[model samples]
Target: MNKAILIGRLTRDIDLKYTQGGMAIGRFTLAINRKMTREKKQEAERNNQPTADFIGCIAFGKTAETLSNYVGKGNQIGIEGHIQTGSYENKEGQRVYTTDVIVDGFTFIDSKNKNGGDSEVQDESYDGFYPTDNDDIPF
Candidate 1:
């Protein structure tokens, strides 16, 4: 019942770290754009305002590693998870509230190769065949 899904670009690179117990955690910000209706668009233009929401997200374990290694700022991705809310006391003695999407799944939205592929699309076929650009059959 607490599920949420989002598709957006990374506001910045993912921050990956590990705990003393070696648990991996990653944090990132996503910039999600709101659909602009004609009226809203006009209002935004008049106000010179942005029409996007920045969301905080967190992932764990291999997911964290994957995101940290392969994702970067401006990279578009699809995310699915639940919203988590918490509060912590800061040094100022004020209670700081926090909300984040605890990411459960992520999808790569760009087809452009993260790893710049060779001149030829080099890949291994499902049948255990390595295909090269020179090959008459595509990989």
Candidate 2:
């Protein structure tokens, strides 16, 4: 019952690291734009402001390595996970609250890019389906 779904763009490049036990861990930030009503959009336009929410996400194990390897800044992604919250004390004796979506699954929503940072996943070897045409897609 603690599920969270988020669709957003990567605010920055993904961070990939490993735990002492050799577990892969990836951390990234997503900038999700808030959907606004017409009134809200007009108000925001008048105010000249931005309407995006940046969220922190963490992935472990194979999921961690997969995300880090495939995407970088400006890539759009969709994630499904649960919210996790914790607090830690800072050097100034202040409590730092942290919230993150511990991702269980995700999808790459960006088109395949040939740039160096993001590698092109082989189509024949990929098990996931990538449609070659818009036909047969049931809307």
Candidate 3:
């Protein structure tokens, strides 16, 4: 199982682009914090900070457009995906390997609204994955 689940803040606004065949793609990085607790009081006092890990992710197709329109820097989100690794030659002819998550599912965990209501924004044509009132039970 190559699956990964992450909940983090976006480092910046998504960079959106289209492929030659007009498939939309959005790329972004997520900053996740790791909190450490020290056993010793003196040591804990000296190291009371949270470390962050930045992860690269990519969303394609209608998902990409939805992400681009709805998300921005510092927005909190939950992602479910799989890891992908690839290598490419740089301008200096040095090969670089990159590992990134290919997003398969995403959920808005934090509302952009200041009043704590759902974000009024909606993408009606988001690859048909969004739920409709008639589709299921309300919980």
Candidate 4:
């Protein structure tokens, strides 16, 4: 029941690392733009308020490896995950609360470039029926 769906751009390149057991872990930040009216946006802009929320995210195993290999800063992606919360004692002897989205799955929302360009994905291996002409239709 605790699920989170987010669509945003990466704030930086994913930091990929491995555990002592050799399991891969990746950490990244996502920048999600806030939804607002024109007037509200203008007001916030004038006040220098942030228009985007930066969220911390983490991935594991194959997901982590895929993210590190294919995605980078400025690339948009859609992620499905759950929110995790914890607290730890830092070097300063202060309790630091942390929240992160543990990614379960993700999809690319951007094409080949960060500037937004149109591209086509040609999957030649598809086996689905594609009628090249009207004569190929059975119905």
Q: Could you say which candidate leads in TM-score? A: 4
Model with the higher lDDT, candidate 3 or 4: 4
lDDT of 4 by residue, 10-114 (tens): 998999999999999999999999999989989999999988999999999999999999888888899999999999999999999999999999998874554
RMSD of each: 6.0, 7.0, 8.2, 4.2
lDDT for each residue of candidate 3 in 1-139, tens digit (9 for 90 to 100): 8999999999999999999999999999999866654445446556873367899999999999998998888789999999999999999999999999999999987756555544645664674476678657676
- Model 2: weakest 10-residue lDDT segment is 111-120
Tell me the TM-score of model 1: 0.77
The TM-score obtained by model 4 is 0.82
Q: Can you tell me which runs of candidate 4 are displaced by over 4 Å?
A: 112-139
In candidate 4, how many Å is residue 99 off?
0.6
lDDT of 2 by residue, 1-139 (tens): 8999999999877899988999999999999988998889788878988777899999999998988888878888999999999999999999999999999999988844646333445555555676575677777
Cα lDDT, all candidates: 0.87, 0.87, 0.86, 0.90
Q: Clashing residue pairs, candidate 1?
A: none
Candidate whose lDDT is highest: 4
Off by over 4 Å in 1: 111-139
TM-score of each: 0.77, 0.75, 0.73, 0.82
Per-residue alpha-carbon lDDT of candidate 1 for residues 1-139, written as tens digits (9 for 90 to 100): 9998999999888999999999899999999988989899789979999888999999999999998888887788899999999999999999999999999999988433557542124453534465456667675
- How many residue pairs collide in each prediction? 0, 0, 0, 0
After the best TM-score superposition of candidate 1, give how far the Cα of residue 131 lies from its true spot, in angstroms. Answer: 12
lDDT of 2 at 28: 96
Candidate with better TM-score, 2 vs 3: 2
